[model samples]
Target: MQPEGQAKRLVIVSDAWHPQVNGVVRTLTKLREQMEARGFEVTIISPADYRSAPCPTYPEIRLALTHPLAIRARIEALQPAYVHIATEGPLGIMARRACLKNNWRFTTSFHTRFPEYLRERLPVPLSWSYSFLRRFHNAAEHCLVPTQSIHDELAERGFATLKVWTRGVDRELFRPQPDVDLKLPRPVFLCVGRVAPEKNLESFLSLDLPGTKLIVGDGPDLHELRRKYPNTVFAGKKEGETLARYYAGSDVFVFPSRTDTFGLVLLEAIACGLPVAGYPVPGPKDVVGASGAGVLSDNLQKAALGALEMGRVDPDVRLKGFSWEACADIFESVLTTIGSAKVLKSRKVKSDRVIPAP
Candidate 1:
C-alpha cells in the first residue's frame, strides 16, 4: 500500500506490451515491477485492454482500434499523478492527444529506430519519419532515450528534452552456469532476438565462422531464414531459466543490428559471462566498447573470432551500475521534476491574479 501523504499513482500508456516479447516490453515490465514495489500504483494501458487489429507486415504486434476519446476517458478516470507514453504507435498517439487536450503533462520514450527500420522495408525517407518522431516526442516534457549515443543522434535530428535511461539485466536469472551445456558444436556463436530484417540477422548467418551458429527467438523471417540456412540451429523463442541457460552455454553472443537504440541482450549476455561481438554501431559501441567483456569491429567475422578469446567475465564488475532499482530511481526522478514544475507554475499563476475588482 502507498504511504498516507504521497501522491504515487502513475499511468503508463504503451503500444508495446506482453504477448509480443522485445526489449521495450521487457524494460516496461521491469520498470512497473520496480515502481510498484516502492508503493506506487502503476496502471498500464495497452492493446490487450481493447479491441485491436494486427499491425501490417508485423502480424505479431496488435494496434488498438479504439478512438482518442476512449483513451481520454480512461486517463481521466484513472486520475494519475504522473503519465508516461512509451511508444509512438496508434495507442501512444491517442494518449498523447488526450494529454494535450486535457492540458496534462506526459513524458515519452524513444525505444526503436523506426526511421531506419522503415527504410529497410519500405521506400519511406528517413527525414519524413524522423520529422514525425521529433514532433511526437517534442510535445512531451521530456523524451527518455536508452543511451547517450542515441540521445546525441536524436538531438541532432531536432528532438527536444532528451534524457538517457539505461537498461538493466536480471543478474540472478542471467548468470554463468558452469555445468549447463547446449551440447552443440564447440565455440557456438549465438544471436538471440526477433528474426526480422531490421535485426540484420543475415549478416551474422552469412559469416564463415567455426562450429555452430544458433538463433533464439522468432519473427516474420524465421521460416525463410531457417529454410535458407539449413546448417544453422534455430532454437525458437525461449524464456526464464531456459533462456538464461542458452546465454551461459553459448561461446559468444553476436549482435548484427546497426539501428538498435540500445541492445538489452548485450547486458544479458555479459551477465551470463558470455563475450559479445558486433559491429561498431551505436548500441554495440555504447554497451561493449573497450569493456573487455565484448569485441566490436567493422569486420563482424573478425570480432566474433576475437570474442572467442575472452575467457570469463565478472558480472559484478561489468554490470555494477545496471539494476532495476537504479532504472526506477531515474524514472521516478524525472516524473518528480515534471510534477514539481507543474505545481510551481500553478502557484505563480495564482499569485499574479488581479484582486482589485473584488
Candidate 2:
C-alpha cells in the first residue's frame, strides 16, 4: 500500500529529556526534528515529563516514572531497528539491556563526560572511574562524540568505536540583527544552563566584574546562588526564540565547565554575534580556537578582562561550516554502516568475539 522503500524507525533513550535543560536534550531534539522531516519516525524514552514545554516548578527535577522497566517493555514492543542511548541512567540501562537481549545493534552518544561530572559532586577521582564509563559506552556499536580531540582521548582510553558528531548553531535564529535589545539596568552578562554545582557559575559571579551578572536558567542551586549574589539577575527558563534573544542581547557568555564535552551555547553566542569569555576548558578551547570569537582563562581576573575584550570577536568565523543538516547526514551514514554485518565484524577484536571494552 505504501512506497517500495521507507525510512527506518529510530528510538532515542535518555534520562534527561524534555523537562531537563541540557546538551543531550538539545542535540537529540535537533536530530529528531531533522530525521522526522525526511520521513523517519522517531520516539524518545525518557524520565522527564512531556505534559508541557518544560517541567513545572521553576527549574524542577522530576524524578523518573515509577518502574522504568514497564516503559522499557513498551519500547521493546515497538521494535525499533536503530536505537541511540543518549544518556546513561536507569532508562538507558534498560534500553541497552533491551538491545543486548535482542542482539539489536545500537549507538551511544558522548553527551556528557559523566566521570568528570561525577567528580564535581562526589569526592571521586575521575581518572579511576573513566574506564568503567568507557566500557558502558563501548557496549554499543558506535559512540558519537563532538570533537576529534575527545574522540582521540576516548580511543586512547579504550573506547574503540568512537565517531565525531559535532554540534551545529541555529544560525538563522541566533544571527546578530544589531537592532533588538533587552535594555538591562547596566550591562547583563549571562551564563545560561542548569544552575548546578558542576557548571561552576560561582566563578563568574566571584569575578568582581562590572555590570549585572545574569543567570538565565533555573536549577537546584538557584536559591543558594541568589542568596549569595543578591545583585545578580535570575531570568528563569526561556525557550525557542526567547532563548536565542537572550543569547543575542547578552554582553558576553561565561562558560566554566572544564568537563563539558562540548558547549553548544558557545556556538549559539557566536551565531548571535556575541563574543564569549570563559574557562580554557575543552568546549571553550576548541570553539574559541575555531572562531577566534572569545578568550579563555582559568584565573577570574584574566577571564573578567577577556569578557571586556568580547567585542573584538569574529562571530562569522564560528558560524562558517556548522550545520545541523550536515551533522544529521553524517549520523545517517554511520547509522547505515552500523546496521551492516561487515562493519560489525571488522570492528571485532579478531579474538573471534566482541572486544573487551575499557
Q: What is the C-alpha lDDT of each candidate?
A: 0.88, 0.73
TM-score of 2: 0.84
Which lDDT tens digits does candidate 2 get at residues 239-286?
A: 779988888777777787677888888888788777788777677877
- TM for every model, in the order presented, reads 0.93, 0.84
Q: What does candidate 1's lDDT look like per residue over 139-238, in tens digits?
A: 9988999888999999999999999887898999999998988999988998999999999999999999999999999999999999999999999999
At residue 302, candidate 2 shows an lDDT of: 76
Error of model 2, residue 40, in angstroms: 1.7
**Each prediction's Cα RMSD?**
4.1, 6.6
Worst 10 residues of 2 by lDDT: 49-58
Per-residue lDDT, model 1, residue 136, is 99
Estimate candidate 1's alpha-carbon lDDT, on a 0 to 1 scale: 0.88
